[model samples]
Target: MSIEIIGLDHIQICVPIGEESIARHFYLDLLQFTEIEKPENLKKNGGFWCKAGTISVHIGVEKIEKSKSKRHPAFIVSDIEATRRYFEENNVTIKEEIPIPGVSRFSCFDPFLNRIEFLEYI
Candidate 1:
């Protein structure tokens, strides 16, 4: 049988230990994503999950000191300019805009320094 790949089920973003609260503030308070309960089996391991539009976003705990900057998740938003302004007002570092033929977009680092991209279709 051929492989039939469907849509994304989830994306796991990693953060160092003891930074879950900081991550929550960025994801929940700033980004406005709703917090969701992690599975009981996984709760003991730390970190949590969040509902981002239709897909699940899992924030996993890592023991490392620094998070990678290049690898990231790009989210489709309604107004990228407004989103950029919000990030700026919140003091989050905004990276350069990535120009795609029919999209307006920019990238930023989360509280833990993990990269996140926001974009809107033209």
Candidate 2:
């Protein structure tokens, strides 16, 4: 493999069609990600973009059936407990309790049942 790879540009997670508002509520309002406008040509396809640190998170639209899975995007946070408390207060189920050495973490499902992990280094 001679190809050189650069760092991540974005990670796209899919939600059902017409659920962009729900995604907005969770990603923007709850998680505090800033929404970026989708390009004009791409607007008709639905979905939107968000800024998360140096990377972009793309919420794509597709017809989907909800299911639980371990695969998820783990976001680094400054305060794990405070983030956890926010999710708890919002009624999002905190599904895991195991802590990695030197780090604190928890997993939860977004409104679309997309598993998301939030962690912080201790």
Candidate 3:
């Protein structure tokens, strides 16, 4: 039998200082992410979790000073161009528009300087 991995489970992000609080403000307050409760054992890890549609995003704080957060999250949407227009209307700087042959995608940075991609499944 072949392995049947259907879709992505979740993407975990490690933030050393535990920006779970701030993340809530941005993703929940501004972006309207639904806050989720982690397992009891994971409570001590110092992180926040959110869910949007079928996507699960978790941000956990690590205890390393040397290692910094260097990755960005790509959230899925129905329309890429419309989202870009929303960002542009809000004065968000659109970094680049990449046409990947048959995909609808755009790249930009958040106020915190995090690279973000808005993409839609073709």
User: In TM-score terms, which candidate is top?
Assistant: 1
lDDT by candidate, in order shown: 0.87, 0.89, 0.72
Question: What is the lDDT, from 0 to 100, of the residue 1 in candidate 2?
Answer: 50
Sorted by TM-score (best first), the order is 1, 2, 3
lDDT of each residue in 6-91, candidate 3, tens digit only: 88888876554755676677667656779899999988877888888888888777664443234677887888788889888867
Model 2 per-residue lDDT tens digits across residues 1-122: 59878878888899999989999999999888999998999988999999977968999999988987666788889998898899899998998858689988989998888999988988
Off by over 4 Å in 1: none
Report how far off residue 115 is in candidate 3 (Å).
Answer: 3.0
All models, RMSD in angstroms:
1.4, 1.6, 3.1
Error of 2 at 56 (Å): 1.2
| Local error of candidate 2 at residue 13 (angstroms) | 0.8
Better of 2 and 3 by lDDT: 2
TM-score of each prediction: 0.91, 0.89, 0.75
lDDT of 1 at 67: 50
Candidate 1 residue pairs in backbone clash? none
